[model samples]
Every structure is written in C-alpha cells, then in structure tokens.
Target: MVLGRQRRQIMKILIAIDSFKGSLSSKEAGEAIKSGILRVIPDAEVLISPLADGGEGTVETLVEALGGSLETVRVKGPLFQEAEAHYGILSDSQYSPKDEKLAVMEMSQASGITLVSPEERNPLKTGSYGVGEMILDAYHKGCRRFLIGIGGSATNDGGIGMLSALGFRFSKENGEEISPIGEGLKDLAGIENASVPEGLLQCSFQIACDVENPLYGENGASLIYGFQKGGNKELLSQMDLWMKHYSELVKEYNPAANPEAPGSGAAGGLGFAFRSFLQGELKSGVSLILEETKLSKKMQGADLVITGEGRLDEQSAMGKAPIGVAKLAKTQGIPVIAFAGTVTEGAKACNQAGIDAYFPILREITTLEDAMNKETAKQNLADTVEQAIRLYRLQHKKQ
Candidate 1:
C-alpha cells in the first residue's frame, strides 16, 4: 500500500549501502547516495546508514551507526610480533541500554594477509593470536556481546594461536608446551583448558561469515583459501592433515565441537575455533549488521531503499549487503534499488533476490584501475544515483 502512495506523499528514503572497498568508505558511499537522492528531491528526508558485512569497514560502520568510538589496543600479530589493533565499542545507542556496550571487531585488522609480506605469507607461520587478544581487550572494557567479522586471514593455524591466547595451551606428548601455528598442530598431543580466561564463557559472539567451507578437506580452508596465504599444493596437503589432527584433538577437549559445520573453515579455521571453543554463532554478516543498526525501524514510512557495493554479481545474492538490505525492504513491501561500481554478468540475479532494479555507477568504459579512482568513483556514484532517481520518478509519474 505504501508503494501505491503518490510520489509527493512518499518523502522518506533510506540509504543503507556498504563501502566501495578500494575507492570509498561506507560513509562516503552513503554520502554519494544521499547527494544523488537530494539532487532529484531537494527536500527529501534521506536517512543514510553506512554498513559493512563484518569485514574491514565493520568497526567504523557500526561505531558510526551506534554512536561510539574506536579503541586501540596492543596485541600479538599473526607472526608473534607486537601489533596495534582497533575495535569499536558502542558506549551509547538509541537501541542499546546505556549500561550495555556492544563491540564490533574485524579479525583482519591484526591477522590479515595484507599485514604480512608476500614472501612471509606462509600459512604455517602466521597465526590468529591477535584476534583473541582483540576480544580480550574488548572484554576487559566491559563488552559482553561481540559482533565479529572473520574475513581476511593470513594463517591456517586451525585457530590454535587464538585458543592459546585465551588460555587453551597446546602441549606435545612430552608435556612441553608448544607455540601454536599450522605446522605446530602436528605436535598437538594434548590441550590444557584450565587456564582459559575467567568469565569468558559469559560472553557471547556472533560471527559475520559468508562461506560454508568445513574445517579440512578439498573444499575446506586449506584447499580453498590457503593458497592465497602462501600455501603451496604440498603445504596445503600438509596443513589439511594437520587441521584434521588438530580438530580431532579439539574434539577431545570439547565433545560438542563440530568443525564440519558451514563456515567452520572461515578465516583459516578461526570459525571452528570460535564455534567450538568460544561457543560463537555464525550468521550472515549483513543480516547481523542490519539488526544491530535497527535498519527496519529506520526504514519505517520510507518509499524506497537504496543499497550498493563495489560490484554486483551472482555473489550479491550470497549474503551481500545490497541484497540483504533489499530482502529486508521486501518484507515491508518497499521497493529497493542498487547501484554498483560495475554490474557484472550475474547481476540480473539481483532481481530475483528482492532488488526491484539495479544500475552501474560507471558512465563510460574504463579500466578497473581508472574506475576505482576515488574522485571518479564518487562522481560516477553520484551521477548514476541521480539519473536512477530521475528514472524512478518518471516511472511513477501521474497515471
């Protein structure tokens, strides 16, 4: 019925778009969209809520959404070196109680592949010890609810390093404690859980994940994602076997651990560690972000919602932010449109995924390198959005 209303009566528009990755930040992208909407209807009430799917921009997006600040902490890096990592804490929010602080973290900050040099990117050498430290840092600051994005990793340690940081020690058959890493898993004779941080069990974690790879196998972490982290074919085979051994050992410590579940292979097996050890729940990243940001409430009485990402493709339907936003708006009977830096081959699928229509930001054929230039991306995004809105208004002209 809302869609049936006249264009003059539909004043509010919601813009919940993710970052353009290399070109624009979430806030910047949202601003571009807002500018576009304002160009068509200068007095329109456009609400811009920048978003991310628990990935690199998660902290900034959530902090901006919930009115919080980023807190920096010193933590161990993937290579056992000192590293600085940041997490966002929602000190206050319109939705959350003042007493409760929600933390959003991205594991890639401290243990991402980009942090390591290409030559030193061996999965066997890197670890996720820093990720656990980030959690502890947030926990010490009184954050009990964690929204974690577990994408972009530099290790295949099966999360041994993270578990070690949280008080689970890996010992060899000789009772000697060993440093946790992918190769070190071969010596994982036993695990000591007595030293795990106290009150850790009281915390709850919601992992933002999109993949469904299991812990170890052809489709698992090592086989699928390890090569990008410097694992050769031979190293991948070895790491896979070690991961199997590590999972078996972990099962001995926690009988309920299920490493084969969907998303268990994410971030070099950090998904398994969180699910099996920390008792975390894995969910679609954009969905979690939507709930945290109270998108539905913000969208109330809106005539249209616009969302976008760096690209639109078949993968957009696989838990991408735009499609997620579209699906939410669909439930409210609101029409949704998306704009992307480039509309790829499979982008037509978005129509079936709840998006009423979509458009590409680029106005002319150009190299990806050229299209991603910050100024170019911004102008293209704004121009495309303006034209799209003009077309939308034309379609709804007095019948």
Candidate 2:
C-alpha cells in the first residue's frame, strides 16, 4: 500500500449542497462547505458545486454548475399583475450539436407563495398561471425540455392557469368562464374547451417532487396544505369540494384516470394538472439533480462528505437533499456526516439512510436568521468539526 508515500498529493474535497433559505443561496452553501473543509484540511484541493433538489433554487443551482447566465421574464405573479421572475438557460451540453438549449426554472420563483404579502394571501385568487407564462416564453425560445421545481406554491387552483396558458380552457354552465383560481373553480360547472397546444406535449417535463398526496378529497392538497396558503376553515372546505368537482369533471372526459392518483396533489394540485392534463411524468427531484450533476462520480474519491439541510428528522430521511447525498456517499463506503439547523424527534430515522451521524449546529433555541450571523455560526461549526475530527482520530488510532 502506498498510504505512507502520499505527501504533496492533493486530497480532493467536493462541496455540494442546497440553499439554506433566507440565509444563503446554493452557491453560498458551497462556499460554506468549502470553508468547513479548509478549516480541517487546509492542504486539500476544493471543488465547489452548489446542488439543488429541483425546488426553490433550481435555476440558480443549474446556472452555477453549467457556468451559464441568468435570464428574467415578466410573468403573472401569485397576485394579479405581472412580475419579473428568474430562470437560467444553460449553454448547450458539450455533446449536443444544437445551438439552443434547455432552460431550468424553479417555478416557485414566479408562482411561489413568497410573492404574496400577509395582507393579500387569498388562495382563491392565486394560481400557477405565472409559471405557465414563463414556460411559454421559454418554449418560444426553442427550449425542448424544462427542469421545473414545484415547491412552495401560492395557489391550490389545480394548475388551471398553467393549462390556460397552453390553450386549455375551463368553463361554466352560463356559457362564459373566468380564470382558474379557487373562486373560479367553484364556478367551474364544466370544462368546455381544451385546445392543448400542438406539439406542446412533445416537450418533456422533469417535475422535482416526491410527495405523493392525491389531488382531491381528504389527504389531498386543500385539506392538507391549503391553510398554510391562507385557506380559512370555510375556504378549506370549499376548495376541497371544488377540487373534487373538478376531478369528477375531468375524469368524465379522460376516463382512464381521476384525481386520487398518487402525487396528484403535489405543489397545490399542480401535479395533477401536469400529470393528467399535460401527460407529464413525476420523479424524485433530488435524485434527478444528483444524476444530472454526476454527484455520485464526485463523491467517489472523497475521504469524507458533509451535507445538511434546514432540518434533519424523519422527513429528511424521506428523499431530502442531505440524505440523497449521504446515500450516494455510503454506496462508495465513504463516511457521511450531516449538520443541520435542528434535529427533530427520532433522529434515529436517518441511520438506515446512510447518515453516519447528525450534528445540530444550534445548541439552544434560537432564530436561525439571527444565529446565522456568519462569523459566529462559522466558528461554532468549525469548532464542532475540530472536536469531532479529534475524536475520530483517537478512536481510529486505538482500533
């Protein structure tokens, strides 16, 4: 073994991560990861690539990895008027002969609930129309496939706005119809028109989700996630009922399906709209990202891999970013450690998912925003790293 003769050989360190929401971007995650690495292994060569799980910061993550520019288009916001939203069109892959390329969109950027203020959060009026607007623009620009992130939505309008943009129409019995907001759905006595764009179905959709909630009735979008989007008790009931009606109406025409299908309620029932109406496929967003970025290859040669998210708990074990990274690391028999904003009940949930250990960066109850005073948090994490590494060295030496 040449283990004793490796001086001057670079110890390769790869920093991959997701954004820490309101505190840092995915790019910032890589920076922090690199900082953590340099603190322990100053001689190691660092490779930084901020990873995204196809939700909130998907566009930025892809742009940074692909070394591309960002573009913003004015689209309908969660509210009524148009707002500028950002997406990235990556440079063509090295193998492709085409001059044009695909554009990555974190649809939440245009249609996310964050756009609505506390004073104006009416789930009845919000819709994914804005996201469709961005998609239509990208389509005109010759993008053939879309990498769309579909988390944190403001509307539970069942993606009526999205279909409308693609030339599908939902109508009422009185011979006229309005837009596809919750309020509009109640008026949706029937769907009179569906002029789906020709060849639009040919374009591929990569939905970044693993949630399996059905589209209507209990355990569906309105009953489960609607309140967070500002559905009142009455409105929650109404939206749930209206979604059922919409489902029943659509199923009559499609015949092969209805709304109770798994993953039909993801992102405020947009999953149903995409999967049923548009013939889109549902997939695990984090896994797709790891594959697209070739993260397994990067993790192969690392001595240790560190990954984290806003929270580490049972949920994290179920297809979260850090777990995805840990699973990949464990496949190569590499040690994986996780740092998180907090550890919830049953931290043991992560044991089987290939997480070697979990570390909560915060010791006391505190606001992550305030505690994120970078200098202090950095020192705290760095100190923890040193202590853990020291303990590891001691145990290994004895063994």
Candidate 3:
C-alpha cells in the first residue's frame, strides 16, 4: 500500500501560504509553514511564496513575493484634502510605472472603508476622489492597462471620482456640473460627457472583483455592501435611489445598458461606472492576482503545494488564494493541502471543489483576537501541520 505521506517526488516539497490576517503577513505565514515542514521532513525543499488578494496589504505582498519592489507616492485620502496618504506601488517587477508597464491598483489603497475613523464614517459625502487621482497618476506614467481592484471602499460615489479624473462630468439642475457623491447624486439630473481625459480614454481599464452584485436596486452595491460603509437604514434607501437615477442616466448615454449589469454593484456602483463609462472589463481578483504574480511559474516544478489563508470554508473555494491554488494544482495532478486559521463547519465540502485536505489551527481559542496572536498563531499552525503530516503517515503506511 502506498502511504499517503509518500513524498511528492521522493524529496522536494514546495509550500505557499497567505497571510493569516491580523496576525501574519503572507511572508510570516509561509515561514510558519516552513517551520512545520522542518519538524516532519527536515530535508524537504520548500518553496515559499507570499500571496494577497488585492485587499489591504496587496501591494506589499505582491512586491515581496514576486521580487517586485515598492514605490511610495503621496495622494489624496478619502476625505479632507488636507489628509495626505501614501500608497505602495510595484517598482522592480513588470508593473513599473517608470517603464510605462501597467500598474495594478486596489480601491482599498485610496478609498477603503478601513481608512476611515469612526468619526469619519460619513458615507454620504465620502468620495472615491483619491482613487481617481491614483488612476490619473498611472495614466500620466503611460500605463495603458489599469488593473483596478474594487474592494473595501469607503465611498458609494460609484466611479464618479475616477470618472472626474478621467474627464467625465455629472450635472445638477440648470445644467450645472456636479460631482457624484451620494448627496450630490441626489441632485444629479444629467451626465455631461464633455471632459473625458485624453490620456485615460486612450488607455485600457479593467476591474478585479469577486462580487456579482448588480448596479442598482436591491441586489445592487448600495443595498448589499453599503451599510458596512456606515449607511443607516435611511441612507440605504437613499443610496439605492441615487444609484437607480444614475443607472437611468447611464443607460440614456448608452442603449446597450442596464444599471442591473452583473458586478455593477461592486465598489458602490463603481463596477457599473467602470463598465459603462470607462469601458473596463470586470474580472475576478483571484484570477488577476494569479496571472500577475505568475504563480504558475513557481508552482511548475514543485512536488506538493501547500496553500493557506486566514480561514478555510465555503468562501475559500470561491475566489480565495487557497481555492485558486487548489484548483490549479489539482489540474496539474498535484495534491493540495489547505492550512488555515479556522475551518468552519462542513469544511469537508471544501474537498469537493479542489482541496485535498483542510486543517484549522484554532484549538481552545475563545475569541478571534486570541487566535490572532502572532506567536500563538504560529505555534498552533505548527502543531496542526505536525498532526496532519503524522496522520497522513499513519493512514497510508504500507503494511
């Protein structure tokens, strides 16, 4: 009988891990996995790579994992022009702005809800204006294909902030031009296509999104994720109404349109704004990250690929890093084991998709914070790996 713990190719092993979130960065996660590997097979040639899904720490994760370097830029923040913020961009790798390569950007860098303080959680006036500036910077740097990740945004202004930078205009009554803030949207009567930026129009644009929310109404951005941006019950209805009106305005501008377009509700109707106005393609963030990082190149020669994230469950199979890795590895005839912070109930179903095994590290943990401590998390992870590998050996040891 062949032991399940049989080496992938008699010796070499490659493991890839993503951040445990609030505890480990993807680098830390990879190191912890390596520590676990050392206990079982001391000589396993582990190839560790960090990963991010274009969320909070996407820039740093990509930079470190793919030998991409960091470039710092000062930009506008979500609110208060006096608010100066910094965003990290790829430097050494392919997305370098110096060489006019396409620069990847995630909405969280400029307009993420997490940046806002409790006092600053006013979504009514919050705008994606900073995101617009980032895109403009990329355009000026000669970046043609903008891979924009639309997630964790503070503003529900749709893509108006970005459109403004691209030379699109919203208008109020009496033909007065206006911005696209939610409150301002209430005053929006028409869209004036006069001011599209020459540079932006010449370039290509795409959205990295995992959501499928439509552009307007109940299934739209405002109704779905708006409350997280601090939308009260009243603003919820108001925001939806505003998006509905903008939807009509968008369709009037284009006959082949519906605010109800798939993924239209992403980024507070930013998806619709991008689709209708910027003519951007909406894609899954996981696929885009995988393509850019060229993970396949690293995974090519690996024996076994161990992938992980902060948690593993039904959602992991959707568009998360572990699921993406598992699917690709399975296709390549590689066995994939998933290690995670915690696995929800019914985690066995995780195997039906692509994962060969799932392990959760939360033992005797009461609160999430308790599980998130760095040393604790690392130890728990090591223990989980040790037990799992031992179990694999026990189950398949030849008689």
Local distance difference test values of all predictions, in order: 0.87, 0.76, 0.74
Prediction 3 TM-score vs. true: 0.82
Model 3 segments more than 4 A misplaced? 1-12, 38-45, 71-74, 91-100, 117-120, 189-195, 230-235, 252-257, 361-399
lDDT of 2 by residue, 1-399 (tens): 376557435566566666666555666656765666666667777776557778777777778766867888988888767789998876556412255466788878878888998778888889888888888888787777777778888889888887777777788888586676767888886664457666677887777777889997779999888988888888888889888888888887567555877888988889888877766777888887887677888776776677776667898887788788888887888787776666798777887888888777765667766667665555555566556655654664576
Q: Write the per-residue lDDT of candidate 1 for residues 249-362, one digit (tens) a residue.
A: 889989999889999999999999999988999998888899888899998889889998999999987768888899899889999998888888899899999988888888
Q: Ranking under lDDT, best-scoring first?
A: 1, 2, 3
**Poorest stretch of ten by lDDT in candidate 1:** 91-100
Which of 1 and 2 is the better model by TM-score? Answer: 1
Q: Which stretches of model 1 miss by more than 4 angstroms?
A: 1-10, 95-98, 363-380, 397-399
Query: Which ten-residue region of model 2 has the weakest summed lDDT?
Result: 91-100
Please state the error at residue 131 of candidate 1 in Å. Answer: 1.1
Best candidate according to lDDT: 1
The candidates, ranked best first by TM-score, are 1, 3, 2
- As a whole number from 0 to 100, the lDDT of residue 161 in candidate 3 is 73
Give me the overall lDDT of model 2. 0.76
